[model samples]
Target: MGDIALTTLGQDIMARLDEAARFSEPGPGVTRFFLTPEHRQVADLVRRWMEEAGLAVHMDAAGTVVGRLEGPAPDAPTLIVGSHVDTVREGGKYDGMLGVVMPIVCAQEIRRSGTALPYALEIVAFGDEEGARFPTTLIGSRALSGLFDPATLDLADRAGVTLGQAFADFGLDPAGIPALKRDPEKTLGYVEVHIEQGPVLEAEDLPVGVVTAITGIERHTVAFTGKASHAGTTPMETRRDALAGAAQAIAAVERIARETDDLVGTVGSILMEPNVINVIPARCELGVELRSPERGIRETARRTVLESCEEIARARGLGFEHTLGYEEDGAACSPRIVAALKEAVEADGYRPRELFSGAGHDGLAMSALTDIGMLFVRCRDGLSHHPDEHIAEEDADAGARVLLSFLTRFGTPRP
Candidate 1:
C-alpha cells in the first residue's frame, strides 16, 4: 500500500474511534456497558457504517451488532471477523474499537476492488466482552456460539436490573436469544484484530504479529471472616484479623506467580468491613485472578493460591470462603489460519512474531464454536483498558492491510 492510502485508512480508523468515545459515560474517559444507552448509541453508529459499506446489518438479541456481505453462492460458509465494542470504566478508545472499525474498512476495500470470496463475510461488534456491567464476560459471543443459558438472563447489574429486563428495555426479546446462534456447519472460522495490549510486540520492534493462543483465565471472590475488635486494644499475637489473613494471602499469590513459569496471579480488588482506622476488620473480600497460556499450569497456580489462602485463614483463626466467578481454558489458534496470517504479514514486508495473548478476548469464547485466529497490532508501552492506551497510525494501517490480505486469499480454490 502507498503512503497516501495508508494515511487515509489510518485517519478514518482514528476518526471512527474518536466518534465511539463520545457515547461513553459523562466523565473524563470512556465507559460503555452492555444494554446501556452509551452501548446502544455506539452500536447504532457502527451499524450505519456497516450499511454504508454495502453490508446487510442488524443488532442481535444479545446486542451484538452484525454486518454481513453475502458470498457469490447463497449457501456458502461464512467467515466471521470482529471484536468487542464495549469498554471498561475509563477505557482507552482503541482496544476493542479498532477491531470493529478496521474490519469494516477492509470490507469497503474489498468492495472497491470488486472482489468476491467463496465465503460470506460477517463483521461483528460484540456488546459485552469486557463484562464491565455484569460479572460475566463474552455474553454476546456466548450467545452467538450457542453457549448462552437462559439462567444467565437473570444476572443482575449494579442497579439490580436483570439482564433479561435490560434486553427488553433495549427492544430485544430474551426468548429469541436462541435464534441468534449461528449454524456451525455453515461457518468457516472467526478472526479478530486487536491491540497487542502488552509490551512484547513493541519490545520486539514489530508492528503486527500472529497470536498463538489466548491465556486461560480463572476468577474468584474470596472472603475471610473474623471477629472485629478495637485496633489499639488488640495485641498482634492475640488478634484474629481478617484483613491480616487476606494480606498474607495476597502476598502469597504474588510469590507463587513469580515462582511459577508462564503463570500470573492478581488480587485486583478488595473490600473490608469496619474499614475505619480504629477497628480491626471483621471481614475482608478480595478478587483473585489467575492466567496462563497453558491450562495445566494455570489450574495448578489457581490451586496453589487457594491452598495458600486456606493456610493463612487457619493460621489466623479466620473463616475462609471462596467462589469461582468465571473460568475459561486457553484457546489455541488454528494452525491453518496462523499460516495464512503469517504469510500475509511477511507479504507486507514485516517479520511475523508469534505470541500468546495475556489478556482475554472475545475470540476465547468464539473458539468454542469455530476455528479462530487473531492478529495483534502493537500498542504504545502495551497499555490498554486505560485512557492512555495508544497505537501508532501506521501500525493500525499495517494490521488492516494484513487482515485484508488474509481475507482476500482465504478459502480460495488452489489453482
Candidate 2:
C-alpha cells in the first residue's frame, strides 16, 4: 500500500490533538485525571470520535473504551491498539492521547482506501494510566488482563474518594470492575503509538521509532531519620542532620546513575519534615525512580542506591527505611510485531532502528498476556510530560501509517 497522504492525516491528527488538549486546560497544560469530570469529558469525546470514524464502540466494566472495526473475515483474533488518556498534573496533550488516536486515524484511512486486514482491529483508550489522582496504574488494561483486584477499589485520592466511588460517580457499577476481563483467546496482539518522551529520535532525526523493549521501572521511597537540632545551638560537626544525609544520598544516587550505562535515576520528589529554618531536619523523605532497559543494570543501580543510603544513614547516626513505590514487570516487545513495524517503516522510505522505551506505559501491562509492540514519534526537544511537549504533524501521520502497516499484519485466526 502507498504511504498515507500527510496532508489529510496531518489535519485530522492536529484537530484531534487540539480538541483533546482543551479538556483539562489547567493553566497552559492538561490535567484530566482518573474519573474526574475532565477525564470523563475527554473519554466521551474519544467515544464520539470512534463512532464518527464508523467503528462500533463500547465501554468495558473497568471503564476502558474499546472501538472495533470489523474485517472481511469475522473469525479472527483482534489486533489491539491503545494508550492511557489520564495525564499527569499540568501534562501535555500528546503524551498518551496519540496512542489511542493514531489507531482511530488508521482505521479511518484503511476505510478510505478500502484496505482489509485478516483480523478485526480494536482501539482502546485505557483509563488512569498516569495514576496522578490515584495509586493505580494501568487500571483499565490491568482490569482487562484480570490484574485489578478488590484491594484496587480501596485506593483513595487526596480527597479520600475511593476508586470504586469514582466509578460510581461516573455512572458505572463498582462491583462490575472485575467483569472487565477480555476473552484471552480473542486478543491476538497489541500495539502502542507514543511520543519518544526523550531526545533519542529527535537527536537521530528519525521519522518514527520502533521500540524493542519497555524499560523496567523500580520506584522507591527512602526515609532518613535523624535528630532535630536547633540551628543556632548545634555545632556543624555535632549536628545529626537528616536533610544533609538525604542530600548526600541523593547526590550519590545521581552519580551512580551517571556512571552506569543506560541507567536513569530520578529523585524528583522530596519532603522535609517540620519546616523550620532553625532546626536540623528530623526526617527527610524522597521518591526515586530507577529505569534501565537491562534488568541487571537496573537491579544493580537500585541496590547500589539502597546500600549507599544505609551507609550514609549509619555514618550520620540516622534511621533509614526503603519502601517500594511502583514495580512494573519489565516487558520486551513482541519480535513478530517489531519486525512487522520495521518492515512497514522501511516501506514508508524511512530507516528503522531498535530502541528501548525509557518510560513505563500501559502496553507493559497488556504485554503480560498478549503480544505487544510500540511506535515512537520524535518529540521536539526530546521532552514529554510537559505543556511544551510536541511532535511534528507529519511525524504523527507517519507513526500512524507505521501502526496501520503493522496492524495490517497482526492477529491470528480464531480456532
Residues forming the 10-long window of minimal summed lDDT in candidate 2: 1-10
Question: lDDT of each model, Cα atoms only?
Answer: 0.90, 0.85
Model 2 misplaced regions, further than 4 Å: 1-6, 223-244, 271-285, 313-321, 411-415
TM per candidate comes to 0.86, 0.87
Tens digits of per-residue lDDT for model 2 on 1-415?
2245645676688788888889894586888888888878888999998997789998877778899998667777778888988899889989999988888888888887787788888899988889898887888888877777778788899999998888889888857766777677887788889889988888888979899889998889999998897999899888889999999988998999999987889898999987699888999999998998788888888889999999999998999999997876578898988988898899788999779999888877788668888888998998888889888898987887777677665553435
- Across 49-84, the per-residue lDDT of candidate 1 in tens digits comes to 899889999988888899999999999999999999
Root-mean-square deviation of Cα positions for candidate 2 versus the true structure, in angstroms: 3.6
On TM-score, the candidate that comes out on top is: 2
What number of clashing residue pairs does each candidate have, in the order they appear?
0, 0
